[model samples]
Target chain A: MENRTAREYYENYLKTTHRLGRILTASVLILLLAAPYVIGIYLKAMPNIPAVLKAFLGVGIVYLVSGIVEYLIYVPMLGAGGSYLAFITGNLINMKIPCAINARDIVGVKSGTPENEIIATLSIATSSLVTIIVLALGVLLMIPLQPVLQSPALQPAFENVVPALFGAMACKYYRADRKAALIVLTVMTLLFVFVPSLIGSTSMMVIPSGALAIGLSYLSFRKKQKTSEGGNEA
Target chain B: MELLAELNSPVMYLICGGIILFVSVICIVFAVRAYRAGRQLGIDESKMKRVITASTTFAVLPSIGILLGVIALSGSLGTPWPWLRLSVIGALHYETQVAEAASEAAGIGGLSIANMTPEAFATIAFLMSLCIMWGMVLVIFNGEAYSRRLVSPSHPEKGGKKKKSGMSGFGDTAMTAMFIGLVSAYIASYIGTIVSGNGMFSFQGSWLPLAVAVTSAAAMGVFIYIKNRTGADWVDSFSVAGSMLTAMAAAIFFGRLIG
Candidate 1:
């Protein structure tokens, strides 16, 4: 009886959230419609697409596909119009090369509204489109280089780049949230280094590292609270 | 010892040292920038130091492992051993597949893993496995979430609040690192495969490719760290520079070695 009551309550909660989502979706759609026209004249008068247009197109294709996905999933089915606009703009933001200063504007307006929900829903959709487009352009742009992504052996080398980039970012992150950063970084490092040894060659190291980081960070938080309380009493 | 001996080769040392040095210098520069940015942002200094320490460790250790692995493996084998190489590549490919599959299995989160070709499946699996493995290692070592605040020097999140960096953007760095570390490896493999016309471990020229692969892996690690620290602007410049250098180095080194 108690379990049944809980389930019933959950269903009611879900319905309320659903209704809320619909209202938010409508708000975002309204915002999106106004965005382009506001800047459309300037967009029209803009100079020729830079040679970087090719690169933008590469990422843009991916973003476009992602937008299409959003259209199908949210705009059409879920009735999320505002997300459609956010998706379009997000891709545009990503496509800008050398420095697209528009990310702030694109993602910023999302605060404290139904727009945030829609944007969150469309994030992956936008990323997928952008990634695919960028890759296509990358292939064409990098044709002169030849065999960079094509060859089998070299692909592994390419795989490593993402992690290195993350490592660099980790350094910066560490500087900001020292306690949490140290805890997570240390946890991940241990995972990357020791897990392979423990589980043998077949084991995947990164997952454990990421998990460990999150876990340890959580525990450390509790430990910190305990210590701080003890100090207060002393 | 023999592995160390081969690593001592001027060319090999140059490759290893140069790459490591490049990465270290980039990290140091970025760390300083991050420090300044944090200072400007009013992040506590002690907090910044801890983050830096964690980031440095994360960046350096995996990289050293990868670099040393490449140098040692290459030096010892003198030829790319198909089985070992295949397994490593297979692992990466498979991990990626697994991640995709897991996401898809969640329904609406990803494309169906069942639909992927064998190669694609392997790739996803490789990525997923790596993530899992690394995550575990991290937990065992220190047990933290590895979250970091990103204050875009140029683009701040809404209402001037800082945004947190996630692992999603590391994909770009992975691509760059792969090119840098493995172009020669790719060329070698392509030439060997064409010459031999064999399948499943037929590609040759083990050292160059392995080195590239491992270094690229290192780059992925470092890039992740860097992306979290610097602005996208910085990432773009660094990526372009890294890619160009990787291509140039591969061209020069491969030309000399294979010529």
Candidate 2:
């Protein structure tokens, strides 16, 4: 009875949310897919279907595997509102996910709450808007700042954004639970060291690594529970 | 006449701008829903406001990286395409490669379509959008389902209580595990990059990236400590961003030093 009202409340939001999310996301996809072809037709430069398919497969096959992995790994982090927004707006692991997590942490909201959803939605939405604005600014400033942007001085920074980001962010989780973090970090390091080519395929490797972490955490959970139960018995 | 003379066509800008406008409109509607829902849940309006401000601040730095990405792509495809693609669904990493692959398939030897036929440009555009559709499809149809699976994952009802009091501990461990897993997968690549080609294992190349990663972790450590001692959660809020900026600066410094 206690949770019934809240659960029902969440379910209500879920209904309207799913309905709106699907419609909005679907529309964006349709527009994006059609834009290229429509432009081609108007310009009398319609894409050759064979050429399109060949080019697509060349790039598509890897993402075909990697994309699904990202959705599975990232959806839980993004929630419903954030998902529609992020998938449509793009830039997940590097930008939106970090923004959402920071927003949630700032307010100390746990995951899976309406509050968490709000923080994530607000953060991601805010970040996306910021990104678009920055891009618009970049479009205007492109010629003026062209030399600075392409300068060798700044090349290393942009090239290393992912490593710079994850290195800092990972410390938070590692502090929270050393056992799980250590195991995952160790395995990831060794795997990457032995098989350096795996660096290009990091997105694809998320599942296997995440599974190993989940499995280890579950074991730790069971161990803690068993010890606590034994303590109570004693 | 000089504005978009060569590759920056007027029509391209119009279409890209329209798409950006469409996404912004949808974004506002969703934010309103989440905002109202927050108030209903007894969340302080001020707290939500802070999340907005902090998130916006944090966003500025990473968005700079994305800006660099746009600039790189523009050199090849021109401004309108990268601007629209990156602003919408494309990532900084994927768009360049996707364009190159499509261009190559179209028999444009190099990735950039500078000497491009309109047909080749269209093919590249079409392919970039097509490859990214996988995640968007799931979000449209399966987002809510994923959330349901996430928030309540077969951890017995425990008197059917609505609060996560019962499974919060379980949730903490499981969620931590998953996050660490994802982060490790990404971080590992940096380690691999350093060790494999030339660092420890090969002994043939530079490990400047490895130094960047270590410096980043150290900076984060200092910020996290400041957060604990000051009890100013803002320090924690900015810790990750702070660390990233420092590390990026270090990359330039270290790149000059070693690599």
DockQ of 1: 0.04
Shift in Å, residue A45, candidate 1? 54
lDDT of 1 by residue, B19-74 (tens): 32332332233234334433444444554443323322222222222322332233
**lDDT of each prediction vs. the true structure?**
0.31, 0.80
**Highest DockQ scorer:** 2
Candidate 2 has a DockQ of: 0.64
RMSD (CA, Å), candidate 2 to true, equals 3.1
Give the per-residue lDDT digits (tens) of candidate 2, residues B1-259. Answer: 2322434887888888899989988888888888887776667998899888878877887888888888887777778888999899889878888888888888888775455777888888899999998899987767776777665432235222564343545765666787788888977776677677554487444466666667888999999888778888667556777888999999998877754
Worst lDDT run of 10 residues, candidate 1 chain B, spans B143-152
Cα lDDT tens digits for candidate 1, A103-180: 112233222222222222233222222333332233234445334444544443343433323332333233434554
Judge candidate 2 at residue A110 and give its lDDT. Answer: 66
